[model samples]
Target: MVTTWFKKFMGKRLFDRYYKFEKMLPVFAIGDRFCVTHAEPKTHYSEKDIVNALVNREIIFNLTWTDNGQAEIGSVVRYLYDFFPDNQEARMFGGHRPIPISQNYLSRAGGKYIQIHNPSWYNIVYVRDMKDFLIYRDIFSILPLAERLAKKEEI
Candidate 1:
């Protein structure tokens, strides 16, 4: 179907490289003081279950494709808290729904879950080490610098 056509268009070597890069992406990632995901899980899942789901296509789909509003933020925060009781300040970051640019970002469950999807938008979260982490769009922007780099690489 479309994938077959894309593979042909990209050539075998390019297609294989793209596929390998895609596979390297995680379904969900838990940092020392934060959790990042494409979207919220439909139900509470244990750390073990989440790790196992990384290899299960159906579970991966559920983790990445589920709608944002289905799960309550408080519940998700509570579930995460249970998993990492030591990190009381741990927060969850995810993006599936495109939040309004005017809104900037949406925080639910008392600012525990942050839903940010706008390509030009970003958020800074300060962690326990007094370090700040920037969470922005999942896709890289094709800005002038990126375009210049791409052209330079081509030459």
Candidate 2:
């Protein structure tokens, strides 16, 4: 398996250290009106499922590694609603798919999901209060760096 190969390549000590660090990270975080995750859930997860996944190594590995682009926007919205019912304005923020630099962040299901993953895009979203937020993108620096890199030949 790729994971087995990766672990071997990394060696036991390095892999174990990285694994320990990764285990410390939260699978998801819930704020007053928003939820943040590295990637979307493939299906609606119950509260119990989320809790179990936090402690189950295999579940955490699958959630963190394999399930990218498997979750539909509708499913993600439902998951958000199910988990954060009190906040009707609840939004899910995640990144695994790279959208266009121009597009920056992709909003779906009436702005309930926001996907921001492009480093080249230099997109930053600021959450202020529970309902308001601001998005800032730096075009000035990004464009020139992109242009210079694009013109360079491979060594």
Candidate 3:
């Protein structure tokens, strides 16, 4: 019915390498798994400003494509150099390339993510999101206290 590619798209090898790279960082608690406040699309923050946002700092390293679904390597490249000519790292590592995202990954990655224009390229997960995946075992968490506080403050 299905092929191995679909099954392993985000599994095993990728997860192993990703986990090995990330395990070097200090561990965080479950409450630290999500952004305390919402993050704007990368389109909103400048290079310096995004770094200052305290949470979701990975957005600073990503390409922010505002145009809908024009996901091609050439198109992404043009947008990158035009928007961030001064950036040297983006020219070298294809790390920050932003492609059109599916609704599915958004539900998983939560705060911020980047898709590769090419399906073969791995979808870029934000550092915190990757942390949520490896640590919390789920990106979304149940925050009853925060929910109650919000409801009480609304009245």
Candidate 4:
């Protein structure tokens, strides 16, 4: 009963956030300097062009939302072209699942699940059907747990 109202109230607002990239605050390490990288060199864009593109791209899509949405080159994100070949983690990724959240997570989380933040690794998205996120919403979220259990050598 209460859950229905909550969803009704939020409605599109929940999905709207997915479009706002700049609003997504940058997560920084204690002493980490913001950096960006460009993994692939296929793009005709020069160093400066890539950096500007990254920021521009950041505004429309959620950079941290998906593996591809994120810049593969951490350097492009943190250092820009000033240190391109030197920095490589910022490989700019370009991919998207245009399906709505409901259809998108149908395989893993249906529409009700949300991927929670993880301390040690990437986000492990969950859906309402599994009931996993309900009991262990925070402490044992999928992020590191899934990776840790999946393989002893992956990480």
Top model number, lDDT: 1
Best candidate, TM-score: 2
Question: Sorted by lDDT, highest first, which candidate order results?
Answer: 1, 2, 3, 4
- The C-alpha TM-scores of every prediction are 0.67, 0.68, 0.21, 0.25
lDDT of 2 by residue, 1-155 (tens): 86697687978788788889977888877777778777665555676877778667655654455344566557767777777777777787776667677777877556776777776765445567556554343212254556667899442
Instruction: Please list all clashing residue pairs in model 3, or write none if there are none.
Output: none
Positional deviation of residue 127's Cα in model 4 after best superposition, in angstroms: 32
lDDT of every model, 2 decimals:
0.67, 0.66, 0.34, 0.33
Lowest summed lDDT across 10 adjacent residues in model 3 is found at 28-37
Q: Following a full C-alpha superposition, what root-mean-square deviation does model 1 have from the true structure?
A: 4.9
The segments of candidate 3 whose C-alpha lies over 4 angstroms from its true place after superposition are 1-65, 74-104, 107-138, 141-146, 153-155
- Compose the digit string of candidate 4's lDDT tens values, residues 5-96: 64578765764664365345432111121121212122234445543554565422333334422334332333333444343322222113
With a 3 Å backbone cut-off (N, CA, C), the pairs that clash in candidate 1 are none
Better of 3 and 4 by TM-score: 4
Model 1 agreement with the true structure over 1-155: per-residue lDDT tens digits: 86799787878888888889988899888777777778766566777877888567776876777675777446667666876777666677777777776655677656777776655544333344313444344222334555677689652
Model 4 lDDT on a 0 to 1 scale: 0.33
Cα deviation at 23, candidate 2, in Å, is 1.2
lDDT at 102, model 2: 73
